[model samples]
Target: MNITTPTELSWIILLQSLIPSYKKRAERDTSVPDAANKARKFAQRYGEILESLKIDPTCQGGPLDIILLCKLREQVLREVGFKDIFKKVKEEENEKAISLFDNVVRLNDTIEDEGKRLESLVRGMFAGNVFDLGSAQLAEVFSREGMSFSATCQNLVPRPWVIDDLDTFQLKWTNKSWKKVIIFVDNSGADIILGILPFARELLRRGSQVVLAANDLPSINDVTYSELIEIISKLKDEEGCIMGVSTSNLSVANSGNDLPVIDLKRVSQEVAYLANDADLVILEGMGRGIETNLYAQFKCDSLNIGMVKHVEVAQFLGSRMYDCVFKYVEV
Candidate 1:
């Protein structure tokens, strides 16, 4: 879908902020002797790597940088499984002296193996380094502007997504007879807001049902029915249309004009009615805290939706997280 709104871009910006914070913590924690010892042992066991790179201690850099290097050294040692003599740098007798000696040796060796630089060495150790994933990786898909993902993660910088990335939403739902479509929504981020609106309009056009599943209140960027209305307000102001709004179980219903709201949670009968009658089901989740999908899973399971097939879609922001889309097939 063409993500053509500034609001959609906001979603990218919000998520980008998380990468640097995580990386900084990772770097800072690397200095701990207990953790460092394990890391060093991991490195030493992979002897060929250390031998090839020749790391050194006398290299001039910030203390934090040096500590991070030490952390990398420790990681290398542990990865290769050298259990014996893997001592925490501070705990050892003559800690400073020992560190100095080790640093000198690493520095000399590292200079000799210029091609196998410390950064490259550490990067190789992780196979896929965390920092690499956040900046260049995530920015490629989400941030079209000249957003530096690498620098952001390394420096712990924050950036917000533009609204455009979220403008157009696509919902794919099918009935046994191919007569309907449904849109499931989770977060109230600009991306989802923009995406869902377009998707909802399209579903209505096709005579299908569009359901938006969100929490009762706003938690971070995830929206509530009120917030959804606010988005609708902005969209209506900009585009002059509010044609295909949902009224399914997940759709918000106002009990009174004074306060535009609905029961944050819909009834089981309502959900079942939508599920049974739906040619397809789109289940969205709440964004912050615990995910809404976990609750939805229980509901789907209770409804005897049968075997749930999970599809891992993408790994964003250098994280090990897998973005999943699931399919439940009825036997």
Candidate 2:
């Protein structure tokens, strides 16, 4: 159950590029009283830890990598009492995305060709992935001018993406049907409600049992298991349908992950159990899909879909910021 990392990835370079942005986010966190002051303290302590690791690598006391760095950052944030820094924004965006869910689905349904429909759904996934507050640039843009789901979908970068596998995946889509799919979801608001849910609905309609594994605790704006359950509850009718699709086949699991980046070997027992029979495994968003587990191999067919939201990631992939990754592998 150990996930693999790409040999090309340099933990030192990636950590150096990412830590500054993360510190900026922590400094801007307004979830606690005297927020700016407390955030500065958190950043100071976190930076000290990183610097110590640099001065004496062995001082890290564990692997000096993205997972360890992110865990350290979160540990510092919690020590400063900054819990769920983006909670309010997540709630607000979730409401907005919920209101637009039907319209989004109806539009997807209008596409008569199944291939085109699938492409559109995947595009929607990339677009919604932009609602991430974990990215310093996107967070600022979102705070200044809120995101538009449809606009984003329309504005995705032209095809032949950095890691394009859509055409191949479409062929598989037309030729096969997976019995069970486990999507490691990311972000709140449009990311989940408008993007992933619609795609998951498609799987449910195709008679696949789907399990959405969300973070057990808040990390950036990534949705939590409880929040995902509530979102599903609101989207489903009393008859247990979501826009005419039955949701009985859909369920949510806690990922036992608190960082935006995930280490598959450490997931909750619940998700591990659910994934046991899965025929397809999808890791969504930049954190899970790109930064941490882009090259991970699985026993079943796997897809890693997300938008490259960080400069470091884009550099590593040799793609521009906001470029999409739709890598698919059939085993």
Best by lDDT: 2
- For residues 1-331, could you state the per-residue lDDT of candidate 2 as single tens digits? 2222343134544544545555665566665678777777876787677666655555655565678877877888789887787787789999999999999999999999999999999999999999987776787788788888888989999989999999999999988899999999999999999999999999999999999999998888899999999999999998999999999999999999999999999999999999998999999999899988999999999999999987778888899889999999999
Instruction: Encode model 1's per-residue lDDT on 1-331: one tens digit a residue.
Output: 2222332223223333433322232333434556444444443343333232233222223222212232333344334333222122112212222223323223424444323332222212111111121223432333233222223223321112211111111111222222333333333332243234444554454455455444343222234455555555554423454432333323542211110111224433444455554455444321211122222433221111111111111222222232222233221
**What residue pairs clash in candidate 2, if any at all?**
none
Query: Whole-model lDDT for model 2 versus the true structure?
Result: 0.87
| Reference-based lDDT, each prediction | 0.31, 0.87
Displacement of residue 24 (Cα, Å) in model 1 is 15
Which segments of candidate 2 are over 4 A away from where they belong?
A: 1-31
Ten residues in sequence with the least summed lDDT for candidate 1: 304-313
- Tell me the deviation in Å of residue 195 in model 1: 2.4
